[model samples]
Target chain A: MKVNELVQKLELEVLCEGESFFSDIDGCFAGDLLSLAMSNVRAGNVWITVQTNMNILGIASLTEASCTIVANGMNIPDAVIEKAKDENICLLRSEKGMYELCLSVGELI
Target chain B: MNSFKVQYTIDGEDFSVAGEASRKLKKVLQSLGVDPQIIRKATVAMYEGEINMVIHADGGVIDAEITPEKIHLFLRDKGPGIPDIALAMTEGFSTASDNVRELGFGAGMGLPNMEKYTDYMNIITEIGVGTTIEMIVNTSLS
Candidate 1:
């Protein structure tokens, strides 16, 4: 699923679009723990987390994650949004909490 | 097959800039046309080490050497060393503060993840002195 689709499906706001569009996601891992997420998530997984920080972009880069969904309507810091754009990592914002967002996205995937 | 080297200083006192070195290394490897799997391994291993540096030590230095044969990484920190390497290697054990946990790391899997992805890992530390970790990821065969 492309990030645009996710944005539309979940009614998420586009905080920033990194590198245009990524068409498909292989899996989904919803976690904030960097170590566990890196070890368990695959290259194309859509990372769903509430943490809106630059390190999230770093983790996305390491894991080659397709997109990052910041859950619970959290405000993303400007520096982080810029970094995500620079690194071509898509960033999305969801008003829903972590659990519900994961469940809905999981159903889509 | 030529060798490339880059060095980065990690400030352990600041958690915000933890993975800068790993992020740069990943980009360099990608540009070098390294296999995705090998690049992923190197990046993840180095990232774990990078996070450990910030969380445990005040910070440290990460030296990355990339060549056709392998990727060599060194993370050296001047912080309280790990007293029990065996226990620290466990999956769920973590000495990270609650504040660090809230930032989405310090789950106690740093060393284990680094070890899992690299072909060789060496950790040397003295309780009061510091800790140094050296990891090698073979790229030629993989």
Candidate 2:
């Protein structure tokens, strides 16, 4: 699935350039724990996390994650959005909780 | 075997800048044409270590040595050290305060996850002297 598809399916607000999600996504892993996500998620997997901290962006960049979906209607911090834009990483904000986002997107990818 | 080394001072002031060293190393490893899996493992493991140092120890020093067979990471911090290595290694046990947990870490999985993905790990510390962690990820599994 492409990141754009995830954006559409979840009805997420694209805080940054929505076109970047056109990149291919290989899998999906949803976790609030950054360490677990880093160890478990593949490079092109879309990471679904509830974290709004700046460190999350660094983790996403290091793992070369395809995109990040901040679940549970969390306010996407300006710093995080800025980092994502600079790194060309797709950042999406969803009002849906982690479980629902996973269930909805899991079936697709 | 050819050898390479890089040392970085993790800045204690900026939490957002914690993973700088690991990020740079990942790029270098990729440019050197290191195996993808090896690069991922090393980068993930080291990145976790770097974050741990910043969050728990108020930053520290990271020494990395790249060779034909493996990548070695030495992370040493001057902050208060762990009292019990065993308790700290448990998946859900954390010494991090509630404030740190709010930052999305302090989940008590740092050491365990570090050990899980690396080939070998050793943690040395004293009550007040600080902690020194050594982690090695083999490029080729034996």
lDDT string, candidate 1, B19-134, tens digits: 88888898899999999889888888998998988888989888989888999998999999999999998988899999888888878888889999999999999998999999
Model 2 chain B lowest lDDT segment of ten: B95-104
For each candidate in turn, the TM-score is 0.92, 0.93
lDDT of 1 by residue, A32-78 (tens): 88788877778878888888867888787678777888888888889
Model-by-model DockQ, in order: 0.79, 0.77
Candidate 1 residues lying further than 4 Å off, grouped into runs, are A20-22
Candidate 2 DockQ, CA atoms: 0.77
Residue-by-residue lDDT tens digits, candidate 2, A1-109? 7888777877888877533478888888899877777787788888899998888877777777788888988987788788778867678888889999888888888
Provide the TM-score of chain B versus the true chain B for each model in turn.
0.95, 0.95
* Candidate 2 global TM-score: 0.93
By TM-score, how accurate is candidate 1?
Answer: 0.92
Tell me, by DockQ, which candidate is best. 1
Fraction of true contacts retained by every candidate, in order, equals: 0.90, 0.77
* Candidate 2 global lDDT: 0.85
